[model samples]
Target: MSAPTGKALEEVRAKAQADVRALRKRVDHLDNDAIDLILRQARSHYAWTDKPVTDEIIHELYEITAGGPTSMNTCPARFVFVRSQEGKERLAKSLKPANVPKVMGAPVSVIIAHDLNFWTELPFLFPHEDRRPHFEGKAEHAEVTAFRNGTLQGGYFMIAARALGLDVGPISGFSNEIADAEFFAGTSLKSNFLCNIGYADETALFQKLPRFAFDQVCSFA
Candidate 1:
């Protein structure tokens, strides 16, 4: 694809600028239904319908999630989508009893992981400068950054799925060691968490739980 130029570039920039202005106004915001679909009405779905989540949808989900920002664009998040029966069985071995059925029943279980040596790609991802050397000997700092950003990316994945009309049940009830051995063996990647993705069974949800109010959770410097 040729790079957009002239009128196309101007149109793109103009649309982006208009979007920013609209966001600043906060008046032409997402409709209530859209907000609900992405956040409010969304739930951590444990039970799923029989509808299969296709590869195309998974690809689209990754495309959307990949757009989320990361520090120095490290983007260490790695996903292993377990959709086959054998994959589910392997994942089940790592899950707690209560979470096994959830994983097995969902259309797909995503193993969200991060590469411990993510900084090795800093030269490519953040190529404007030589940044890879900074993390070469800093194992502790690199691991921390990878895990933190990987977890954040997983959150973005869940939101992206929700935005695409899919339900997600993210859980930490699985054995990371087992997951790593089964799915990421001989690799630098380490499992962060598991997320079941599919259409939800509304009847399977429990009453919504309460959340801390904004006033109770925020403070000014």
Candidate 2:
């Protein structure tokens, strides 16, 4: 990778700025090399190399992902890092047989969960007023919204990991009820998804899948 010249940097920035303007939005102008690498190939990675993912990278991923928006700033998303062999073992028991080997071999496994009672903390997280009152009588509503948005945050977590030079293999082919029992016992948090993180094995990549074009999947109306 060559260093970007000042003129080249300015040209890319100006083009991005114009694109955002045409799209009627203002995006953060952070110049991140990992972001460039991630945008080049954002697909899910299956096989992984022996290279390990560091704790520092995971911390940075969370720091960046938390900047994404959440409803009422509720930020109900919670992440459980499964790094040790034992920790991975516990989660592996809940995995479908097909996923067991993939997850166990990864450098890190993440349990992305949503707190069913996250609104309880709204008084502090959204402290302008007693925002808890707004969520009090709407228990079911809170759960639904939290699950939806928390799932979105999990997606952001994957992208952030990819943006920080890690590849992700996110999976939902597990027993959620069993996962909750094993990992989050006695907690209001419910497991939404699990993802494996590590350096990708390029040789293991499948042929790139096709995607629908804009007109095939969207409407101007």
Q: Give lDDT per model, in order.
A: 0.92, 0.85
Q: What is the C-alpha lDDT profile of model 1 across 108-212, one tens digit per residue?
A: 999999999999988778765778877899999999999999999999999999999999999899899999998889999999999999999888889999999
Candidate 2 clash figure, as a count = 0
Residue 217 accuracy (lDDT) in model 2? 93
Which residues of candidate 1, in runs, are more than 4 Å off? 1-28
Per-residue lDDT of 157-177 in model 2, one digit per residue for the tens? 988887777889899999999
lDDT of 2: 0.85
Q: Record all residue pairs in model 2 with backbone atoms less than 3 Å apart, i.e. clashing.
A: none
Clashes by residue pair, model 1: none
lDDT for residue 61 in candidate 2, whole number 0-100: 92
